[model samples]
Target: MVLQRMGSVKVASATLVAALAVVFALTLMKGTYSFGGFWSTEAHRNRSIDLQLFDAWSNPTLWYAPWLDAVGNVALFIPFGFLLVTIVAGRWRIPIVFSTLLGFLVSVGIEVAQYVYAIGYTDVDDVVCNTVGAFLGACFARILGYRGRGFVVTLFLVGALCVLAEMVLSVVF
Candidate 1:
């Protein structure tokens, strides 16, 4: 019975992982130049992060409409890492270091696609943010068992709490 349960989990995980990989691959391959209706113009370069249009990072408040952009980027890749740890084979559970590498590879691939297909620029900031988001997702799986309902959901909530807590910390302490 125990073995059968594990086998089911393995199968389910594998299927989920395969599906995620395919979606990710296709998304990366397809270059949509008019994504978000905001990235259409290349004139946002003058909006500096440090000096000109700074937001209260400590507050976790949205700086312009870009807060949605950041959240969107972070939320987009959560499933990749989740699928990695959950469905990957026994010896192939994605390690943190490997996850980071995967993030970098994905970021690179996206940037390359954008450049080759004339969709987006090769921004270093995007790479850093993406890698961080992926890691957070993978770390969620690692700390939690990665397969199951109760604990996995708890992990996701806790992870969000941590991110929120960080912002709260910035303000409180």
Candidate 2:
């Protein structure tokens, strides 16, 4: 029994790390990186931020862009929350609190990086969507109880799909 529990923790931790890697890769390295260019005057001119919540949805010319961004941002963090709950499974309150805080912090970190690196827009909507997604995932995990390896495997599958989607989008656009 102890061995099984240990194994579950290991699997959850590994899945969490992989999920986070995917998040960073998709967030930080989405666009081609050019450090010198980022520091150049021309590159810095394009940097943008939207502090107002849900501002992305108001784009008149690009109605679908905001929806896609919101869904993708939320989906990206779901697995993180699920795996986090699994890692600390059996505890009711700790898992929820841990996942929520960690997920929010992670989202904020990514947003800050996006601004500093100028790789993408720094939108408050993304943070809100991500935190909500994480919280939802944690709730699901708590409700479903610890399914152990199954959840980890599912997370991997989801991560793969996300990566594939990203690749296709990059190639197409």
Candidate 3:
């Protein structure tokens, strides 16, 4: 039993590192990360920030694009949450809380890097969605019985249904 747990931990750690590397490559090197022309005007031109919370929903013209982006952000951090919780804790309570907190901190770090390096839009919306994603991922890990809930699953189901309803409404009305 001890050896099995140790092996699992090692696997989780490796997978977590790989997942984070992919995340960094996707986010940090998104728009621009030129080494030679780091301070060029062109790099600064692409840099933008959106501080208004859920501002995307305000524009009807944006329609499904913003919603899709929100889902994508959540999906992106799900693996991080899952792996981190698996590696860090054997119980559900601490893993859920810490995974969410770490997710928020990591998302904030990514946003800060985006702002400084001018990689992409530093939007608070991403932070919010990413945090939620991490929380959900931790909950999902608990559900798989690998660590040892219906609550989070039900909540996510409801939320997903609501999103679907809104999408249909937007198209019909």
TM-scores for the candidates = 0.54, 0.77, 0.71
Predict model 2's lDDT versus the native: 0.73
Q: How are the candidates ranked when ordered by TM-score, highest leading? A: 2, 3, 1
The residue pairs found clashing in candidate 2 are: none
Error of 2 at 75 (Å): 0.3
In candidate 1, stretches whose alpha carbon ends up further than 4 angstroms from where it belongs are 1-62, 146-173
Candidate 2, 49-151: lDDT as tens digits: 9899886666644667677778988888888888788878765558888998999999999889889878668889989999988998888777776544464
> What does the lDDT read for residue 85 in candidate 1?
57
Per-residue error for 76 in candidate 1, Å, reads 1.3
In the range 12-37, model 1's lDDT, one tens digit per residue, is 46444544443343234223222334
Better of 1 and 3 by lDDT: 3
lDDT of candidate 3 over 15-107, digit per residue (tens): 566567656755775443332222333544467999999888888454786877789899978877877777776654588899999999999
How many residue pairs of model 2 clash at the backbone? 0
